[model samples]
Target: MPEETFVIAGASLAGAKAAETLREEGFAGRVLLVGDEIERPYERPPLSKGFLLDKEARDKAHVHEADWYDKHNVELRTGTSVASIDRAAHQVTLSTREPISYDRLLLATGASPRRLEVPGSKLQGIHYLRTMADSAALKQALAHGGRRVVVAGAGWIGLETAAAARSYGNEVTVIDPEPTPLHAAMGPELGGVFADLHREHGVILRLDDGVAGFWGAGQVSAVVTSGGAEVPADVVIVGIGVRPNTRLAEEAGLDVSDGVLVDQSLRTSDPDIFAAGDVANAYNPLLGRRIRVEHWANALNGGPAAARAMLGQDVVYDRIPYFFSDQYDLGMEMSGVAAPGEYDEVVYRGDRESREFIAFWLSGGRVVAGMNVNVWDVTGDVQALIRSDRPVDPARLADPKTPLAELA
Candidate 1:
């Protein structure tokens, strides 16, 4: 009998993790992991930190050692992209004109960095951090330091990249339309904490400004903002955001929203097809809504959950959405999803001024979201609080003496 075949698109963290789970779960199927990039499946978190700082090896970034794929009977296809999905025939057409059929298909296509469309964007020194190649190129340019580095966007990628560049001794300037960095995501009070952190590190914050265009003879020389002000720049990194790679899923006639729509089990409109990672706008039963998260933790956990669901296991991809960031001396872990205007109050424990605190967003006396900065070993507690959805006294919630477990 022919082996049951499983095809996974976009050999990313989610893809790799799924492949690993398939064998671990005794699937004994033919696994084909396809990717458009030339490298093997790898983790992307280190791209902005250790990899950029030259403290991480190229091999260290990979999800598995080189021999792992072959030993597990997984077919690895690098530098290949899916051209179309033939849902009717259960086959995928590749860019190379090859067609592969699958009993189960997983789309882990992920997302691409949103680009700036302004004039002079074609200039040579402009960069976007999305791939290993991008990280390597940016690291090479920032290695010498003393260069004028202008980072556009105050999102996680932008801020992390700025921290890496600054650590290399480069004079850095960060631009964003918000009055302060991370304002939209974390609110102004907590966002101010990050702004102050960057300022203390000697990084200039160009807040409440929009980029008009770029200025250069050939390579980028400066970034022109809305007020006709030009910030001299030898290199510019844009990290505005990312758009999920949902075209193939859309073409395949699956439900597509901000991302590919998946049920609570990560199953798409077609049961044989599933989506995970950044490309999946999966329903979270715990949150009572669908959310598309582009962070590492989602991919790490969602991959296995989706795989288990594919195997017909009784499971749901309901893990609390979480992500963490490291900038300079700051380490932060955030859990739970904050629906727009859902939280009525922000409760704080510890001292924000001292950069050691945990902030909780409470809605109807229940924790909706929690963030711990420069605080460790409490993410599990925060996760439990959000999961329990139990009411807690605001005073106790803000007291460092009150254990997070006790609040639940």
Candidate 2:
């Protein structure tokens, strides 16, 4: 009998945690984790929140200590990229022309920030927030304050970065084509709340307009909008969105849609191969549909589930979609999928005027998703309501006096 070799591509949060799980599950076989980044696996939330504000230390985002991999006998290959996977030969070829054989493989290649296609986009000072280096550079550019910071897109990334910019006393302006900030995520009902929140914090909002182009000599000095208005900017941050990285899996003859297609067990089209993290559009039993989550919690939990499945354990990846964001004095946690038009109405408990409340999205009188803003310790109860799939009285739900647990 020969010893098995397990290979994981993309040294991201998912890949790193998968390696840790394999060892903890007593897989003594050769474990190799390869990534293109020079830095070790790190969480991304801090890049837009705490770290960007310089409130969190630089070393706090790492998945494991600098020495954890070496001590655990895991082969940590940083600054190395997987160019292709030869499925026939059960091997992955590196960019450096190195080939490694693997009995089983995991692809957690994550996603990349989508860039603007407008003119002058190549100008200096136009930034995207995806990597640690990007956050560091943006922090340096805004930390001094008094700079004109123009952010394109009013999504979580854009708004959070805008808050950080304002925290430093910089003049911050956020532009988005949608009617309200977070329009796509929370819909118009709750999006209005965020719009007011940012405005109250001294962040300017330019809604219903899109960036048409940039103007500058060598670095960005201003942004021209579709509405024919020019907004001055010393630094420009683009946070539109991201696209999943599925080139490796796609080229390997695996099923690919918006992301790599996988079953409930995280198994790809090929049995010996699997995908997780932002790259895997996995079938979720709880949702009764396929969902590809780009949030940090998905990566944090998906990796371990995939590892257990690789060990021949019965695994069902049905975690409720979850994510969190912090801006200025507000902190929020959202659970379950609340895609546009999927939910009929949103019910609120607590005071919306004070910005302390739990908003529930219900369809057919059943709670599909819930978000708690400036409210703590109700995540489990919120999740339970979503998982129970029971219809509830809207009046009772709206009553703050009614405990969420009783409704569940």
Per-residue accuracy of model 2 over 1-408 as CA lDDT, tens digit each: 788999999999999999999999999999999999999999999999999999999899999999999999999999999999999999999988999999989999999999999999999999999999999999999999999999999999999999999999999999999998998787889998899999998989999999999999999999999999999999999999999999999899999999999999999999999999999999999999899999999999999899989889999999999999999999999998887887999999999999999999999999999999999999999999999999999999999899999999
Write down the lDDT of every candidate, Cα atoms only. 0.92, 0.94
Off by over 4 Å in 2: none
Residues 1-408 of candidate 1 have per-residue lDDT tens digits of: 888888999899999999999999999989999999999999999999889988888788999999999999989999999888998898999889999998899999999999899999999999999999999999999999999999999988999999999999999999999887876566666788899999999999999997889999999999999878899999999999999999999988999999999999999999899999999999999999999999898898888888898889987788988989999999999998654476878899999999999999889999999999999999999999999989989999999998889987
User: Number of clashing pairs, model 2?
Assistant: 0
Q: TM-score per candidate, in order?
A: 0.98, 0.99
Backbone clash numbers for all candidates listed: 0, 0
Model 2 TM-score on a 0 to 1 scale: 0.99
lDDT of 1 at 181: 85
